[model samples]
Target: MHKQLLLIGLLLLVLTVQGQNLWREGEMQVRVYVENQAQADFLKRSNMIGEPAGAFIRCYLTPDELLHIRQQGIRYEVEVDDLNKMSASMGSRGVPNGYYTVAQLHAIADSLEQNFPDICKVVHLGFATGMNELKAIKISDNVHLNENEAGILFDGGIHGDELGGPENLIRFARDLCYGYNNDAQITNLINNREIWIYYCVNPYGRKYMTRYNANGVDLNRDFGYMWNGEGNSSGPFSQPESKIYRNLMLNNQFVIHCSYHSGTEYISYPWSYRAQSTPDAQHHLMLAQMYSQSSGYTNLPYGQGYNGMYAINGSTKDFGYGALGSISWTIELSVSKQPPAAQIVPIYLKNKAAMLKMVEMAGYGIQGVVRDSITNLPIPALVFVNDFMCVTNNPVVGDFHKFLPGGSYTVKVVAAGHQTRVYENVVVQDNQATTLDVVLPRDTGRYAWRVISTHIAGNNPHDEGNTMGALGPPDNIRYSLGKNGYAIIDMCDTLKPGNGPEIKVFENDQTPENYMVMAGATPDGPWILMGHGTGNQEFELEPSGLQQARYLKIKDSGTGQSQIPDAGFDLDAISYVYRPATDTSGIIEGFTYIDWNVLIEKAPGTEIYYRDQVVYSDENAYFRFQADTGSFAMDAIWEMYGYANCPVHLSPQQHLYLNIIMEWMEPVETIAANNSITLYPNPGRDKVAIKSLTNNPLLSLLLCNAQGAVVHRIMNPQMNVDGEILLNVSTLKPGLYIVVGIDETGKSASGKLLIQ
Candidate 1:
């Protein structure tokens, strides 16, 4: 009794000094580093507040503190790591011991496939950079997984060194397949859903015991979805781990792809697209809420990106929903799950139950493809869902992807700048799939600009309020043209502070005196500083007169023109001459993309006509007009009279092509008298053609169609030469058009010839 009181008094003293850092009912566990014995005692007491039996305290202590405890021989339950102890704890029968090596993992996956003939198969998703073999075990029972009610995909070992996730994942699979017939809940979960177990999404990382894959690319960050800012795994499937999993996940209709990572213990949902609320955020929140209730894990909405703890801006979850349309999440497996591994079985087991319940929870589905609308050619477009509540946003790319629950989603596309498009009401049905094919328009337009040089913000200078402001540009317009390739902004004129970022300008064709000039990054050159940070820290460059360029590149110069470069640079935004407004006021809504800098190779002659309709082109290489009929798209053989099959595609990236295929045109009617017909050059050279009376007056003409409709006409005076006439067939697309003519005698004659 006296000892108990002393211990209780000590705990109270600890509590008095250290605030209440206890695990409330269902609260997640994060390691705590107390300052003193009192604080440690308080933490020790609160660690058991709502913790059930068999739980332990794992302190992340300083070397000094560890020494103090060890030297004094203090009696307390705490530890750092016990690799062997963790490896020894086994699950149900048929469940092999956990391992830490890549070879061991492969062997285990292979054995599981062979042992469980009814429900699992080992598949080689892809090979690694070092030519190392990478594979996974797909555990299922329904021979072919035919029409299961739901799909639950579990991917682990994204952060390679985080071995806890792999262990839990293997255990879950073992429990599901092995425990199905034996355990009721397990049986039910397996029967209702095709729970896909994808252990070691980043096998190469796991093999090396590193956090990133062999490519030095973080596996969890490789998804091609939600790819702006710090989003996506180092460049889509660039890492072996992310590649195989991406291929696997995109092919399957998963309701929930609950991936695992260690270091922190939290069940976080989507919106990794950017650090803001997405259109499907409510759904994610609801899932988070459900997760909290189902798993009884404290939910923290802070930094979610591997970059930090805050729910990231562009992540797998972001692309999952924004790109593939799957409700995905990054479930941080705790480093707090102690050793003597058996102590964690319950945690993994409980999560298994929670995951099973989540599978049954409501989920929205999404499906899509990127293809050239005209030629039906598939081109990759960066895609994403824009949430109204965001400071910044970017697009997701690649083929099909997935996210959390679905609902009304707005898909915004940004590729070769062919008029950024948006698809609203991209509705997603629950427990089902929605297919969307994104058609990329051809590029051809005026004022169609690409990024030029990047320097300091133009607004950096002025009578503005900035004291220590030396990095940003001065004045409003100091855009000077240098013989070399930098659009030198004159900031010494009207400089100030509290401005925007550093920027620069250049023409796409100008060869930089130094491609490595101002653009110096950590790795190397060809760097260009765009926009970055807030108004106070970034460099801002003003637009020069007629900003005529396609690709101007710039990099951060240690010049007093912009923000302090952290790590590599402060490049945060890209500026081009795109209609910066959603609501555009124009004669034609079809926007144009042009490189005023790229000199035109062709000179304009008289109005070029196609099918007798005058087609116009601007100074730049772009043409625009509106049409009521005809399905427009990109890439096709434009058969006009004599241009020798000109291959035409859209610029600014093409939108809709209203091609007039005279041959495919539906037969209508014709007026032949003054509307009669005439043919140019009696028996012409390349094209033997005829014209409607709409062409000349001297020679009369007539025509008929399969529908008995007079299709053409021509007159006499409109002709010249050897008593015949020269037929202006240059504008006629290769096809048939009737020609009838009458003389002073009022008698009509008709002739027919095919034009190539």
Candidate 2:
């Protein structure tokens, strides 16, 4: 009897821990009648499923919730009394036989990548809460490269119970890959555009057949924009799934993005949290019309999400449009959440052409690259078309595409460390893309240039002002860091510890408010507190023990009332105080090379370290910085391995040039045996000579300090008849240095040199 009781207790505990599935034994699917947004909000508070539609909202409610609805005097009609039984009658506890399971879908993607190696490649997005790998298939001509091409994304299965979406996505991906060479339209699109299909976003939810993920949080409501603590979301993007999704969107500049759904047949666009239409309302409507017309359905209703369906915060559509400016939306495929197995193919067939049309239209707008005028290299910039704003370019390729109606409009380009450029009356044509390449000169001002791409704006309920106000110059217009609110801004250029004050904070108006400022090297920061201040003030970075910082976080000190307009700290702007280069400071300019030959392409993003300061080369592989005159060891790092050089002595007001060549680190034993180079006067100071024993001529020599920093370099040195190359090491500090020599055939030889 005791053993039976223990067994029963364990069974009950297991069921309790699992919480709610798609349908419980006594749960009922009901249509609730709501008079206004207030009633809709009330239903949401009751923890109901799905959003409101027109005067009625369909949802699954428990017996207790149904009784509460009656007590609240809300009218509701029961659609399905026993949801579990009804679902069982449709098929089984899991998906029907025709529907593909999560494992099967992943297998299909893997097989496609294997079969079509040229155009299809599987990209591992991230792991889900259940430890299942989230994957996306990229379809393009050059699948491996991040080319300057318009990108589009399609994703499905955010809600696990909505099964049709994943099926549609996987099928579409398969079709695109198979039709690449056979179909002309598909071939053209595959050649010109980069298409991404993220099938099965919520693998845990799909496997369990539940609306929520493994943690029981609704993935759809966990986005970071205008989040209001709905659907058990602990915070904005708190869940792993949402974090991975956010990274994908921010990393790629996708022109058009579509998220699939079921339980309703409609097309919904942005402004889901508010009633106001998006600035590109006409453009959204036009695309919706085109998509619907191309699809199998006729007269498919489409409109703004707020009224078209219902108001909701932290939705993927809103995040994609409001934050990143992608043409993003959700497509409701069927009236049934999980339709019968046989209807899956017909439903996919209905929307296949419309998906292709979206890919085609994604390139039909204004497309261009934003670059630096001086270096002629790509840069990330904000492109504003009249009133509609979008982050146009990415740092990798610096290409941007925006779908616009055919008309004349003002186009403004803004970038960090660059002057804002405006093009008046930039005309775009119908069904065709217009090129508007822009080159911005460097900005000499000291003001903070741009806001970090991603951040949580902990806005107060009453007065949550725009964070963009804190960017650019000091205008009277400011962003209010509401009671205990905060924001992160980017300086775009590194700010170092200078002679006097290195930073300035501008508070709007005469009202002085308390705030704390912190700085970090990256956006996700282990922040070092700068100081606390009231109102406008100048701060010195020297006190913080930080060598340099490019990102700043400012927070209100929670001194003001909780509910008030422009409460807490009102920040007008933040800037770096520039001091003229002194005679003690010396400038170093150089390029990072992949090979010793100057004709070869330069390597970008190589890290150059001198003393406590580190800087990365730009897209053109050029790096320039001014540092205080001193004898310091310099190191060039690539892929976390340091390549050493001789010590450098920077004289006052000296202008030095360097070319750092990155080489792979070989085994110590192998490096000593191969190439066969010898160094003489190992313990002597002033100079070192390198003589190669190999047949190849020694073309260049690099002398490094004990710390593996390249301190001295001799390129195209005059080799004697005995094949010996001399290096002037008089300026190098007395230490054990490593000498690396490059042969004419690009082979490398290494030897140790002791300078005393």
Candidate 3:
């Protein structure tokens, strides 16, 4: 009994000390709403907040600075006043209630190991400056040995106050181990991958409910890559907690990693210090999109430069990427710091599929061995695709994992004291891992080739404009009348015919169309026909014998058939496939992705025009679409679009464009309210009443069958004394019909009319 009391006293004293050191001298978290860019810039200049949530910037301020802000008449609200009190309050809620205390967390970890001895093992990851032991769990078929499989690390509670991370990770580990026999997905993931979940990376701050460690250092900002600010006492890795992970990462190989945090619900990838895009932007986006889509969370890819969020440096994800070759990402779990216990399971369930998907994706891409030709021993070599700069190989296993969006690439494998091996025409399929193992011979001469630059001909103005739909500049622009519109691309330098095809043309291949490719040394071409292609597919230039040229022209044959008027062949991008010099950045320099929400917010004149009439003046329409669409268990639009009511994906870019078009065209809410097309007794048994609440006279009302055939037509409908037009839907078959109303201004609104 005395020992228990002594232990309790020690815990109380520790908490007291941690609470005192939390804010240190002056610190308070505030959420300030800024009206314009100037106000945002003002907060930025002060260096208070790292990122912004739309117009609201979350700031950690001092008392003196808080006074200055109020004096400046800046509007602000306190998010957390006293860190100690918040921590204390969080502790009172107990394990899974709000957050678990250090003792409670340790107990939970111990329980997990005891409960699932077959698959789970708790690992103590050394200790922090506060003498608290950091821990993680290893779950796999054989956790005792280095398995010949991909490695995944799920880290949480990097920041002390971010309770959701650790909580969700604990629950996930439990589910994976508990449901192994019953759940097929869990069984597959555990059997295939070596998974590690570090429940809390920073235990010191977790005790105090602060963002920083015991030494007043933010562990996240203590990494080697792009680290800013003065190191606390112990220099870089001076913090014992960071040093442990750093050493572990250096020694082991982790192919994929996801770091969890709270504050905002987002998925941010590597290269956060600069505005430059990652080499594997496409792959990262595919995974990031899948993660958010799986969780039904907001999808934001890459970093602040593209996302409009604030720039964060020296983060765990960047360290894992820049220092190690792991494709690490940071997932902001929720908007709240420590979500209630009831919300924890729901949040985990939402993220469970995404977690499984990440593991599955890691198992994908190209996986193979790099070895010596004679010895047949593994050689730690750098495997690289010319297009993406940062993506490399896992040195420990001599295996390279490269996930490229469906295309062909020139793969180069290089190692110290060895001849570089070059594999030409390596084809990568989407969502599938391709294997290519190569043996490097002794050191030889370096192969060199100039980088080719692409430019469209200025003469074809209509053919090169980005605004004519083909999904901005990256996907290029659209062109119609197959024979009339042709785009000529200048390669900037003379091209020599290599082993395989030298040029690639992106086309809207949905319709049966053929494009004629002609090449010449100059723009005023004495041209030769390179080849012809059909369908909505990328056209690769297969040079015959030894053909070489600096200019390539893609012309529509007009022989291509299309039912839609003016819908000829649409060109996306034209690039020459050149053997690149040393793998470097700036190969394909352009934004490859754009989020739908960001488009709605930033695009000028972004009014939604419905069927060339009734422009939606409200922004809520976008929100409604984002939330309403998508399937319950699925994270992506692919599953969502599978429903009968959902849109179709002819092409990813065009599908999004068409969805936006449909969002504007379909009289969802804005049109139904403004244009006033109201149908009473919606699931009408016999007769349905229609009302037009607009000043414009109702010109015509048409009722169409499920196949869109005109079943009933009311010409020049007259309103009754009560301002409602009664329609006899009784004669219509007991099925679904489209109710379309035309106004005097030629504005048309459509809704569903059901007959039973």
Candidate 4:
């Protein structure tokens, strides 16, 4: 009894010192024995680190936290009293001797890109808190292009202390890059699929041999979907690392996403925040089982994360599966973090076959493209398989792939600006794929066309509905804004307020739930409250004092139990009150191309801007918009390549067509030498002059703002005998501008100008 008391007092003293330090040093790994769900919940609330074994759960806790656990009378055993010291004792400072360091990993990626330029390229994905470059490598037949292929992402090192994941990922990447044409299966997979490898996610944590980033946030718990502020996350996707991950997932349509870790040997998938299985739980299980079977580990297990491990919120696997519709999961490589140097190669060899199999399986299942029935162009659409939801087609290729067990299922395709289509009894085989190309007719209704891609909030994976439910016309299907959750809806066209209610909110169910309707000129809004209502109702913008709005933010009034289904307002759709243009609207249609002279390759992703409205060119390089009849400057920008600007004058009911040729811009020195054009008084406060050394007569002069918008135009400008044209710039803003002179022969010369 005396010894026990002394031990307790010593533990208290250590904890007190640690509490004062505030975890500036590191954390301690502990095994807390639990007898019931309540104990497990307590550990989970304390940010459990690894899966629970028979009678205890393992977690990394600061001394302060351990003291609190002891105060609660929870029996625990200290596995590693100082995780940082243990990590240091494992090998070196950055990583184990055999394991690749963060800098070495980046150098390897660079080497791969340099050696196999045709099959590999490195993509710089933002930076970490410690200014380490977060990078990924793309391996495919056409690595530089976004081809219509099944995309799969394999990432590791999210927890820097998990040394084996990065080692496995880097080895896999090297094998894939080196075995391109030498290996048959590898060559075939490379030719047919796009593989992404993000080797190290937390360089700072890896460098310091810690579990969290420099900011002490666990990146795995920083994702946005169903986020609940666990693992020291300030908010959903609040960290720069999480934001980079979010952007990467949102920009690409990945069919399968695997995040690598090391703490135990298991394959865990989806619904990490709750015990309920995902709607695609069967599919997830089938894949996990296949992966386990393929791996060299004879007793590797696979199951749902919540039950197999413990409940967690804002996990990468959950975000990937719930928000992006990817077959996402975590592959815990070893039973120990930072395994011995001799064990690194053996561990990687064990999971290598399984990783390759995953890449191969990515191409299996339902594969097809969604397109416009009238235009015969590809459409970016969301695909639903019966009760399962949230799969999407690649915006660039309009192609989608979903892996499912051998069975017949219902498939539904929904796209913005198009009618929804459904197919019953779509048959898919176990090992084979089925193609079901769909062409949807256009929907001409005045409704919110698309849900703002990234602004969805208050999403619960356990709910019956998804974000897509708030799209299109009211068809009974709806997304529940779970207790204060909000979704920003994008009206493809602006809503002009004239008389009665200009916007209508549709609540599918009969429940009289209350919600607030707000309007914004942009997606990220300082929202102006239009009005409030219950159930299906109409709102007028007159009270909000807004003339026009392109975005609507609908927030559920926080009421009812959040854990229940449809806890708050159920939103079916939002519609706009359409008032026909009273002889004031005109259409602007155009095609964007790289170069009209040489092979005219259509630039599909070009941004076309008119006034404050911006639209992207479709798959066919075609874009059309209706605008109020007036003189407006228009521009088309192909990012990193070049931009084209023009002055427009619209008459009522006029349908003007243009062909925007975006030529690749050469270096300024090259352009000046090639075009023989010079500008005098370049940084002038009042005026500047442009002269052509070749004596090329100028037909017109255009002054473009920094954003490539044409602000001023001069037709038939007079020039002196020296072939120089003088331009006045006193009225322009004090910024850099591009002065473009078009010769009579249509040859153009550009020079930079600055105004004070």
Taking all chains together, each candidate's TM-score versus the true structure is: 0.42, 0.71, 0.54, 0.71
Q: Which stretches in model 4 have alpha-carbon errors above 4 Å?
A: 1-26, 45-55, 84-92, 445-468, 486-504, 517-533, 537-554, 575-627, 630-756
Per residue, candidate 1 scores C-alpha lDDT tens digits across 1-756 of 699998887687556423421111122222333335564444332211111111223333334444455554444444334322322232221123344456666777777777776676676777764455767666555423222234567777766556667777777766666875897866655665566776776664455444444444444444544222121233333455554565465445465667776655665665532334444556566776666567745543322332222323334565455434456777766644323456456557657757766766622344455543322322334444544211101111123434435577776654433345678888876645666656665442111111111222211222211111112112221222211212211111111111232233222222222222222221112334434332223233332221122233333333332322221122222322222111112221221221123331332221223211235444542455532222112211222211111122223323554322211111111222233334433223354444434433344554433112354444443544434455555555554333545555433444333344
**Which has the greatest TM-score?**
4
Candidate 3 regions with alpha-carbon error over 4 angstroms = 1-20, 34-46, 49-51, 67-75, 88-98, 114-118, 230-235, 296-306, 391-396, 444-756
List the candidates ranked by TM-score, beginning with the highest.
Answer: 4, 2, 3, 1
Candidate 4, clashing residue pairs?
none
Instruction: For candidate 4, write residues 461-575 as lDDT tens digits.
Output: 4576466677767888888878877776666566766546777899968687998998988655668999898999999877777777888888888877676777678888887
Name the weakest run of 10 consecutive residues (lDDT summed) in model 2: 452-461
Q: Count the backbone clashes (under 3 Å) in each candidate.
A: 127, 10, 4, 0
Task: Compose the digit string of candidate 2's lDDT tens values, residues 374-395.
Answer: 3344566767777663554766
Model 4, C-alpha of 533: deviation from truth (Å): 4.4
Residues 478-517 of candidate 3: C-alpha lDDT, one tens digit per residue: 4443343454444433455534455555564455567677
Residue 359 of model 3: what lDDT? 82
* Candidates' C-alpha lDDT: 0.42, 0.75, 0.58, 0.76
Better of 3 and 4 by TM-score: 4
TM-score of 2: 0.71
